[model samples]
Target chain A: MLIDDNDIDLKINGKIVAFTKTFEDIVVCRSGEEALNYLKQHLTTPERLPEFILLDIQMPEMSGFEFLDHYKKLPVSFTEGCNIAMLSSTLDFSDIQRAEANPYVVKLLKKPLIPAVLQEVVKEHLQR
Target chain B: MDTPSVKVLYIDDEEHNLQAFKASFRRQYEIYTATSAAAGLLILQNIDINVIIADQKMPETTGVQFFKSIKDTYPDPVRILLTGYTDIEALADAINHGDVYRYITKPWSDLELHNSIKNAYDAYKAKIDLRNKVSELEKTNDELNRFIYSISHELRAPLVSVIGIVNLVKMEGLYNSSGEYWNLIEICSNKLDFYIQKTLQYYKNNKNVAEHSPVEFEILVSELISLYSYSDRDTQFNVKINQPVGFYNDAFRIEVILGNLINNAIKYQKSTEPNKFVNIDIDVDVQRAEITISDNGIGILNDHLEKIFNQFFKSKNHHGSGLGLFIVKEALTRINGKIEVTSDLAIGTTFKITIPNGKAT
Candidate 1:
């Protein structure tokens, strides 16, 4: 799943991941609110949840950090199976430090997503 | 032209002396006379006095003591001490610690008194002006720092996205078949990123204070060389260092100086030259490091060499934002370093830099 406000970023990152052939299907939400809603809808059915989610740091409403705050409240079954990583164009040190410190975030990757990095994250997740 | 009257305050214990003093300078200045230190405090609160003249032999407080007491509250007013006795110790103490502008003896000459008051007023105005200028500079620096932070983020976001899209296109093998537009996009994106990086370097050079750290030139030069190695240009880097002793200076500033000069060397390489190269030579001692970076590229003209260090001074056929060399010059100044450049058209350019050790002995 890709969560970002920029349409071009979502499309390109989605295409890049698709080319890697790692996931069967990709889900994209334009805002953190919409992404949270999707998670809530799929809370009962863990199988419907995405295996890996690439979240963008900057958004118009409810930024990526805020999304993580709301995400932690959901049942462990939903968050445990899914690996979340923050992808951002932000060059700020504080943003990088906070993302690294967040328990829910697996990695903080700079934009735009490279296919090899996405594959490696998935591989690392399966190994764990 | 008529000049505005300088507001003056004369404080004395005796009534006749205050009257005599005001009678002498009432036409030249707007004189406010107080017969006691307590009354003088009252007048200061009510009016904006430019100069204050106090009698040193008052009953409650000497002139130096009075000046010291009001130094904190009424610091802007220029203070002058008036005394009948020539007590050198008290006068020296007043001038050194009490912020006394000047001390005038009793039976004051009108001409001498007038000159002292005029000079005191001028000093007061200069102090205020200096403070205003300093505050204005701080405001500008703050605005510049904020502007750089926002502009770099705002401009680089979309620019990065475009590069990502380009990367995606290349991975799909679509760019190679229809490579013209893709190559153009790639070139334009790289150029934009380059300029943004240069601007950030300029800001960092101005904002950060130089730090003294032990620098290994071999590692520093190798890292910089690897950075430029990613470029498709065929220019080679030849480095030779003779640093037997420890060298300490601001490593970040040294990087700026070396990075800009090397970047310029690679950037201005003659496209047709098959064997182009940049030579970096460093001779280091405990006191200083002398470095020379030379390149066999499309060399700068004599006329352009002098103006190249000026901010935003772009020569003909210049590919950069013209900030590279200017940042190098500024970084040198901060580190107490010096640079000398010599270039010939179609021959080559060399920059010689001498950076002193910043570590305190």
Candidate 2:
């Protein structure tokens, strides 16, 4: 799943991820709230939940960090196996540290989801 | 220029002296007479008095004692002490310490009294003006920091998106027709990103308070080397580090220092020389870390060496934002570190840096 407010980023990142052909499907959420809603709606359908979440930190309404706060409150079954990777262009060290310190976050990748990073993600976390 | 009347408060227990002072200065100034130190404190609470003149031989409180008492509360008002020759010794110390701005002797000349009030008020006004300017400067500095952070974020977001699109095009092999254009775009974007990062680094070095953490030189130098490897340069890095004991310093600033120097070493490498190399030697102990970064590159001119640490100072073959070395110097200052550079125009340049361990409490 890819979450970001920018449409251009979403389109570009989505296509890049698809080109890798690592995942079966790519879910796009325009905002953190929409992602939360999608997660809540498919709470009972465990298989429908996203296996990996590529979250953008900066967004309108609910930020990626705020989304993580809400996501943590959801039932463990809904979030148990999912990996939250913070995908951002933030240069602030505090923000980077915050993202890294989050329990649910598996990694913080700099923006423009290149194939090499996706492959590393697959090898490191997804393979297990 | 016609100056406004200086508001003067004369605090004295002697009713006659207060009356004489008011009578003498009434025409030239706004005279406010307080019979005792208590009355002067009351007047100060209610009014904005620019200068306060107090007599030393008061039954309740001496003038120097009154000035000292109101130092924190009525700090804006410049204090003038009136004393006899006998009390000069005590008042001299107060004057030196700046608790009292000036001291006037008893049986004072009208000229001396008038001059003291005028000059003291000027000092008071100058202090206030300087304080206002300092606060304004601080406000502007804070706003600039906020602006830098937000602007960088806004600038980088779309840039990375463009980079993403560029990467996608390259992945699809669509750049074969316009490879040069793509390369140019990539170069420009990378330069823009580099400048943005440098600006943020400068800001961070200025704004952040120095922090102390265990520093591993091998890890830090290697990380910086890898960070600069993305640049399309084939400069060989030969790093040597000896850390016999755990070194403690600001990790962020250490990285900034190493990052900029390492980046410069790679960026300024001799393009024609097939065997371009950078040698980073680090020696660390419990007390300090001494680092030397040398490169076989086009070196800085003797004249340019002194000015290189200056903000926005670029050399002839400048490719950086000109903030790299300046930020390095500033970060060093924060951590109480020192740097020295030696270069021969075409042979190479070497920078020696020494950073002391943060105080262990």
Candidate 3:
């Protein structure tokens, strides 16, 4: 699943991820608010939940951090074994540090997520 | 304290006093006089009086009374009271009760009165200058913050797009049968290059002074047309110059302004249609030169027209570096020129540029 507010980034990122053909199914949510709404609908049938969720850091109403605050409170089984990654254009060191500090977040990558960055992360995670 | 055509108004009951005041300061200021306080009030309402000098005693009204009366209606001009009366108590009362800026004793030395008015005008100007500077700072601060955010987005967004596309080409077997998406990668790379060039131009515009020289309008137009015409062969440029000779201005800045507008004309052309054309018209005289460029391309939306010149304002549903019109505006600023744009979506966008003739006004 890919969640981002920028329409260009959303469309381009989706195409990039789909070309990789790693994930069987891909879902995109525009905002953290809508992403939570999506998660709520899938709670009863947790199988529908995305295995790997790529969330954009900067959004209108709810940022990636604000979304995690709510995401962590959900029952463990709904998010169990599901991996979350943060995507941002900011190169600010503190932004990286703050995103890394999040326990639910498994990966933090700078934006325009090229295939190499994603493949490396996938490789590292699959090895573990 | 350089005199800067400061408008000075003197009001005294005695005709001799008013004449004497005007005579002394006529060369230094735009001086006006009234024989009575009532007549001075009339002049105040008529003009943008910068500094008002009223004798303390008048047949119709006291200087302080006149100042107090005009306080609300004519408040901008600094008020000075002139008096022969040596009553310190009265002067103190006028200073406290009236909004009298300063009181000058009568049988005045010309030097004393001149210095007093100069100081009052200086103080008045300082307050105005401070307010303007504060607002200008606020505007610059806002632009700086926006520029920081946009630089990150504009700089990174394209590179990521390119990388993502290149990866797809390698992984998706895009080179095989119908690799049309390869063209997209090419377009993406070009867009990135275009933005990089524009960013550098924007930086250079802010840093350097433009070199001025003779600018032949038709020659510049043809050069720009050839430069852009390479990409889109179908696009046509119709150039017209009413006065091309002896027309001199800052060539580099004009190029910057014209280049950006003409580029937009080419870029926004309706790809599906066969008829793609840009019309350039230049009307010049001794005072100012007006250049109009119109395009029958996929025009800008009505809502986006007002904000096109704003820094980093990209019209929704449009893809660009969003600095084209802004750079045009900045370059125009340096040359004391102005641009007017009118566009109708699905029809066209027309830009009319008026630049001062010789040296930048």
Candidate 4:
């Protein structure tokens, strides 16, 4: 699941993910609210939830951190199985620290998600 | 805003003593007389008196006791004690407990009294000014820290986009319309250019002085409105320039101020209102120009008015880039100009800009 408010960012990242062939399927969400709704829809079957989640910080209604605060409350299986990645353009150290502290979050990637970095993430963290 | 005249409050048990103090300082200062400590407290509470003088000998309470009583409630006013002969001990107590700044003897000379009041007000103001300076420094330091993060992010986003597009070119070898890829690069380049230009504009306004030149207000303003307006043509605009004498001002500074305001007027436009409009009137004379920009859009809340000019202060309703007003204010200050804003919630906002206009010599 990819979450970002910017359309261009979403497109570039989607293209990179497609080019890398990192996953069998991809779920794209424009905002944190939509991402939350997607997770809720797949609540019963944790397998339906995207394995790797790419989230952006500065969204309209609900920010990426706000999403984390809400997402952690879900069933343990859903939270534990998904490895969330923070893909943001923020240079704030506090934001980086908070993302690092979250247990569900595995990586903090600076956007716009070029193919080389995507290939590396798939090889290292997402590899079975 | 600093008041033109110093407000002095004199308190004494004897009405004659209060009259004497007021008579001496009335020409130089705005003097307020209170016959007793109780009366003086009332005046202090009601008025922003800069300095307060008290007589040591009184029926109900001495000057030291009175000063001590009001020290907590009215700490800003500079306190002075007037003591008679052999009241040196009371002066000591006033100094230690009451926080009295200066002591005037009962038979004080006119020159001595005049100098004391002037010095007391100056000392009081200096202390307050220092405190204000410290807090302002701290605020700017904080904003600079936040700005570094924001600027880095803004700069990095575009560079990363270009980097990602380059990776696509490497893998796929090119798209059917390579122009599409080139367009993305151009967009990123323009975004970066805007950030660079705005940041430079902020520094230039702050550090460097601008040259005065003949400004064709009508043409310059119309060009600005066109540049900022969206291509969709949603918001209607009305511009009126009454410039019989072609205005002379710092064109760069004016551009910065007008550009930011015009951009905001368009960006935070009312979505529900069909006939959304922006009205601008520029009236220029030989020495000054007053421009008013009004918009029927989502107005700022009354609380955020004071802070809108502050760096990185964005309204809760409108999540703007947050640098626009800061730059506008900076440029205005450079050109010795001022801006005033009034807004009605859900109705609209209006900004009044006042800048000096002189012939290019």
Candidate 5:
């Protein structure tokens, strides 16, 4: 499932609408705080958990980094096998280093996210 | 011509010549008439005299001796010797040893006196003007150096942040299910690329006067739009190009200009809206080439429009470092280009850029 803060453009949204044929569900959140809250509230049943989250680093309340900080202390069952990829428009080296250092972070992807990047990620991590 | 105000000191023991000298030029000049050498030395201590004319024949001292005494202490004031035929040899000695400006015979003409003083004043003015110019140039050089240093620091800091994030992704063996983390990394990288390009363009434009070349409009616009179109399934943006026939253009500079404008449109668009649209129009003639890029997004406020082109100036909108427009303006200036903008908040903004076809006359 794909998750992003921005309202996906009509063209990309259309693509997502088309791609959903292959996926069972998708989740979206505006901030890392909201994402973490949603995961915690839903983890009790564990059936509604998403396999992937398309995370954005810059947000209003809690950033992606803060979300990861809080996510680390939560029970492992909450995360399970879910992957979190950080997406940003910042080319800052320190941000890149911070994302790389975080264990929960899967990869640091630059915008705008094209199909090639998505395919590469799926091939490297989810191909089984 | 009006006689210049010369500060003359007569040191002759004979009171008659001292009175005669005062009577000769008192009305025409601001004469600082001193009777003795010691009194002349005292006057020099309080006032700024431009020329010091002294009598060669004195009771206790010669004009050469008095001139020698003040040479090092009051170096700027031009020194001259006034002497009778009998004191001609001593006058020569003063002129050679003390570097006196001129030697005048007794009963010197008022016109001759005025001419000498005027020449000395001109010399003094020239020296002061030269010194001021040098000091001003030094200040400008220091400021330019400081500007280059700060630009380097700002660029490097962001680059370091991007590299650090990239390293973490590679070394930590961490895996994420969400694509958000990767998006952040991409944003950082793109920003770095923009800054590096800007720095290079600035350096190149400043270093050479003749290196700018005509730009290709249609090709550059196509390339920029394709680069920003990141999502395969995202809203598609249509870029349009219309140039007047028979117009030749400078392709390189136009690329840099359009690159910045289009980048901002993509970067600062309203986030809540799903139907994001960016439009570009280009028209060129022999005299100038005009381009307009408009986007359906959140627009800039009135207060920020004035400072939008200033270095490192960013609007309250949280998308860019504010260097994009600044760099665009700089690049445009090198080619004698002009840019103007009109926008409505929350609706859209349009940028109109005109590039002169040939070098500015």
Candidate 6:
């Protein structure tokens, strides 16, 4: 799943389309609130549940951090088969440390995410 | 913002003396005349006078006593005494106790009167100008504080978004078999990472003051070329550094300025063109060292060249926050260095920086 508050620019979306060619399914959400709503309704029925969510840090009403706060309260089943990765365009040390400290957060990815970074992520976590 | 002329208040008990004084200096100054000490004070309440010249003998009060009363209220104005021969002792007391500028005896010359007034006026003007400058600086300082606050808040918002995405990917093992899905996550992550690094560099550049040291020009240029050479391999861009013999300059500031220029040159270098390159030339003289960086890339337009050093000002085609040149300019200014730029669209851009060779005192 690809999630960001900004309507992803054409350059970024083009990159995303090329990336999703190998996946069986692709889902997108505009904000943290919409992503949470989608997950809550679909997780119980097994109709659609994303394996990983590419979450953006900034959003209206519910930010990425606020979404995580709410996500922590949901039943274990909601996240039983899911992983969360933060995707942002920021280099603030405090923000990186804060994300790393959260139990649910898996990794921090920089924007304009390219193929080399995907390979690194797979080598570190999925291959095992 | 034109300030009003300095006001002068002259007090004397004799009506003819008051009229004579006003008639003599009225055209040259903003003059207020009073016949008694009480009337002189009432005039002071209405006008912001710079000088107070009082006759030593008045009907109800001595000149020294009246000056002492108004000293706190008009501390900046130079006080002077107009005394007859009989009041010479009182003039001395006013000079010692009340801090009078000078005493004019009875039957004073017009030239002497004019000279004293001019001196007092010049001193008053200096005080006002200094006060104005200090207040203006305080206003600018307040504005800088506001800018820092907004910059911090804007930076924090994007950081939170990146963290949220990382958590979602970890639990599901979503891209286990999907190479394309993995690529999407990677691209997002890399862009975020680049932004974070650049932002941190910007913040650090603002806060960090580079320690001054003498730097060898040839060695520093070679090191900078090597640092950027690897990144330019795919584009196959050529970089050349030419340094004169025995050339040395302020090392820390030079490193920062060169780093930003080289980075910008590489960033704007067009991918389609082969044989793209950047060149650095260093010339040392007795007084100053001149370093120039020239690049054949997408050059800036005429309008943007003037404002390129302003904070957060970027070209429309560029992707970064537009802070690199601004930081470079600020760092150079701190070291008493100067920079000049020339560019032609589709041709190239060149930046020439001149730094003093000797150690700064």
TM-score of each: 0.76, 0.90, 0.41, 0.50, 0.45, 0.44
Cα displacement (angstroms), candidate 4, residue A3, comes to: 1.0
Alpha carbon deviation, residue A101, candidate 4 (Å): 0.8
Best by DockQ: 2
Each prediction's whole-model lDDT (CA): 0.88, 0.87, 0.81, 0.82, 0.69, 0.72
2 versus 4: better lDDT goes to? 2
Highest lDDT scorer = 1
The C-alpha stretches of model 3 lying farther than 4 A from their native spots are A1-128, B1-184, B209-211, B359-361
Model 2, span B1-361: residue lDDT tens: 2878788899888888878887887888888988888999999999899999888878878777788788888889998888776665677767765488887888899999888888998899999999999999999999999898789878989998888888988998887667499888887887888888888887788788988788888888887888887764588888899988888889999999999998888888777889999999999877788999998889999999899999989977666677999999999999999999999977899999999976554
Query: Candidate 2, residue A99: CA error in Å?
Result: 0.9
Off by over 4 Å in 1: A33-45, A48-53, A60-85, A90-108, A116-128, B1-51, B59-61, B68-74, B85-98, B102-126, B176-179, B212-219, B239-249, B281-290, B343-347, B357-361
Q: DockQ for candidate 1, please give it.
A: 0.70
Query: What DockQ class does candidate 6 belong to?
Result: incorrect
* Model 2 interface RMSD over true interface Cα atoms: 0.9
Looking at model 4, residue B39 earns an lDDT score of: 91
TM-score of chain A of 2: 0.94
lDDT of 3 at B284: 89
Which tens-of-lDDT digit does each residue in B275-330 have in candidate 5? Answer: 88888888777788788899887888888888899988876647566677887888
Higher-ranked by lDDT: 4 or 6: 4
Q: Report the lDDT tens digits of candidate 4 across residue range A24-122.
A: 888999998898898999898766788888898878899998999989988887776678888876544457888988887877887656577767876
For model 4, how does the per-residue alpha-carbon lDDT over B290-310 read when each residue is reduced to its tens digit? 999999988888998999999
Question: How well does each candidate reproduce the native contacts, as fnat?
Answer: 0.88, 1.00, 0.54, 0.75, 0.00, 0.04
CAPRI quality of model 5: incorrect
Interface RMSD of each: 1.2, 0.9, 3.8, 3.7, 11.2, 9.3
Tens-digit per-residue lDDT, B178-262, candidate 6:
6677657756654564554455555555654555566776677668767766556643334343444344444655776887788
lDDT of 3 at B335: 86
- lDDT: which is higher, 5 or 6? 6
